[model samples]
Target chain A: MTGKLAWTKIALPLGVAALLLLAWDAAVRVSGSDIFPRPHEVLRGIIQLIEQGLLLKYVVASLFRVTWGFTLAVLIGVPFGLFLGWYGWAFQAFNPMIQMLRPISPIAWIPVAILWFKVTDKAPIFLIFLASVFPIAVSAIAAVQNMQPVYLRAARNFGLTQLQLFRRVILPATLPQIITGIRIALGVAWLVVVAAEMIAVNSGLGYLIIDARNAGKRYDLVVAGMVMIGLIGLVLDLLVRQLEKFDEVRWGYANR
Target chain B: MQANPTVQVRDLWMSFPGKRSGEQVHVLERINFEVRQGEFVCIVGPSGCGKSTLLNIIGGFLRGSRGDVMVEGQPVAGPDPRRIFVFQENGVFPWLTVTENIGFGLLKKSEPERAKIVAHYIEMVGLNGFERAYPRELSGGMKQRVEIARALAANPDIIYMDEPFGALDFITRLKMRADLVRIWQSEKKTILFVTHDIEEAVQLSDRVLVMSKRPATIQTIVSIDLPRPRDLDSAGYLETRDRIFSAMGMSLRIGENEKEALPISAQQPV
Candidate 1:
């Protein structure tokens, strides 16, 4: 029964997708639509795109854009969040600007990214960083703010000085939330990297898709790049979640 | 000669500003008490009668509105490392192991000394096997024992416990009270305990203080005067319990009608 149940879970989603693809295939053949290609045709094009090395080139470029931008976001975001969370004046002052800039879309910043960094890879990197930074940072800040007052009081009652309190209590408590934020931001960075690359960078998965489309061939490369992005993102997210479990077991802070 | 007193409160007045008015509402009014060195004094009153508030004031965690509290003749300004406080709430930090929690206050000591103190307290508390275990792994009673061990390990001049067993089940609370008396006798340190449990106050205290309501003040101080190893069911113990209960506005007159009840000794402290 367990084996049969496991098979059903996989079969359900697969069956739905297969049905959708069959419908899409039938529609294209019957209607002669140029926009929606048959699943088999897209799969076949993927093989050809790989043969031309076009698929590999775009994926690597997009990966590079995401990697650099995500790293910069974490580097800046974590400490900025910590500061805004820990200190009253910093939170009060920075909160307004944070909320304002946070919701602004990465694509919307394309013109300024081009103007400010001006056609260099930095422009796309900046755009990806813009998209990723706030989710992680804001989550970290919220984590710190949500800490129980008793935890601080208990530390103080033990006669810990402020620095010790920060190192021993605040930092440890904020870590899980910060990690959650980083995972979320990393996902956002990957999502925006394609858009950023299509506009700014000369190469990447996003570049590969757009470049393939511009070449008037190979919808397969675009589909291949999209699949790779989703698969790679799932792997990265899984890695962080596993790390969170390890921390939860070791630290025993949040009881999760 | 009587043992020297460690704490002396002279006309201690503690009040807080009222919510909507300019009035200074009193918690303990003109409170004066002295804890003899090595004496165990438990303050018992109704729940809102500010016994815990007075304990906080003694620990130097709160300021008196007027008058003074002196320990070893020095006035208390804030929480003194010399006086350790064990609160009723789970006092042990959940993240720390039993050994780590016990060693917390002893951080200022030499490493060898801290290790020695931690080992000693762990043994005394019968938690030797669980030294490396986290507080979350321990039961509520076990956690309270760890708190007591930690407080004892600090070797403070006085230990203030605010209903340390208040959260425990009945059997556990009884066991803890007995354990506390044993520790107090062995260690010979001053203890000022706060509880609303009349039985606990009567059983453990060298003196039981009962406080009246808001703008609260000590309504009476009744010395147990019974021989230690105190017998809670003994004649003197029953008498003392009745006296304190009476001070708390409960009449044991119906129960007191029983023939040949223990005679309560109320010595007017000069």
Candidate 2:
């Protein structure tokens, strides 16, 4: 029974996807449109890109920018957030500016990124970094602020120094929330990289879509790029979710 | 009075600022008490009578507005490793397993020593099979046991409990009380426990301190002269329990009229 239930969990989603593809094919055939590509055509386009090695190259390029941008965001954002969360005066001084900047779209930073980095890889990388850092920092700050007072009391009763308290209690207690923030920031980073590449860079999935359309109206390749982006985003989310399985952080999540 | 006092509170007063400016809300008043070495003392009072606040003050989590709390002859300036507090709420670190939580304060010890101590406490708490289970996986009573074990493993001279079993079910609380008595007998740690349950106070402590309502003061201190494995239905137990109930101005018998039983505010229309 368990095996059957598991099979249905996977099979049901795949079945819906198959139905959607068939509907798309029917719509195209019934309309008799020449410009729009069929599902098979998109599949063929992906296979063609694979043969030409552009699929791997473009994927690697997009991933490379996202990796660097997201890494930088985590490294800088977490510690800055911890500081803000720890010191009341520091939060007071910096919070208004963070709140003010947070709501503005990361896409709004595209112009500044281009002006600063001049159409290089850094432009898109900077935009991805901009998109991701705020959520990560804000989540960390909230996590620290919302920590249980009993834990702090317990730590103090143990005679832990301030630094030891942070290392042992504060960090571990807040980590589950921080990991959630990292997951959200990664999604935003993936989104911003695609947007950034469409405007500023020359060789990623986003660029492939724009280039395919402008060069020869290759809608098949465009659709394939979108599919690849969706697949990769799902993969990235899955990877980050694995962090929640750790024994030290599992309590933060609800049991299945 | 045979043993030296392990804890002393001299004229402790606590007050917090009221919502209105220049106004103070007195929570505790002239709180004076002492727990002799290896004695189990329980503080019983009405809800919001500031019994927990008094415990916190002595535990060094909060400061009294006036007076001093001395433990083992040293004034409590702040929380010390030698005195551990088991909170009313679940205080076990959710992120840590039973073993890790029990070993939390043993960070200074050698790895082997810490492991041995953690293992011993885990066994003592009857959590032998759950050594690797996180607190979230345990029931309320089990989690409280983990907390008690954690406090004992630290080798604290005194354990301050603020209604530690208040959250457990009746059966679980009874079992916990029995197990706690067993542990206290073996460990011989001086304990100061606060609870609103008169029966519980009578069951666990060598002395029970009853407190008055807000701006609270120790109204009376009744010493329990019963032996270990006390019989709850015994005439002596009932008599002592009745005395505490009367001291708190409560009657065991329900009033004949329901309306007369309730306060005026509770009698008002919704």
- For model 1, how big is the iRMS in angstroms? 3.1
User: Could you tell me which 10 consecutive residues in candidate 2 chain B have the lowest summed lDDT?
Assistant: B255-264
- How much is B239 displaced in model 1, in angstroms? 3.0
* Residue B41 alpha-carbon offset, candidate 2, angstroms: 0.5
Q: Compare the candidates by DockQ and give the number of the best one.
A: 2
In model 2, the runs with Cα more than 4 Å from the true position are B256-270
DockQ of 1: 0.24
Distance from true location, Cα of A177 in model 2, Å: 0.7
Question: B69-125 in candidate 1: lDDT tens per residue?
Answer: 988888987777667888888667665789888987776799998999899988888
Residue B136 error, candidate 2, Å = 1.9
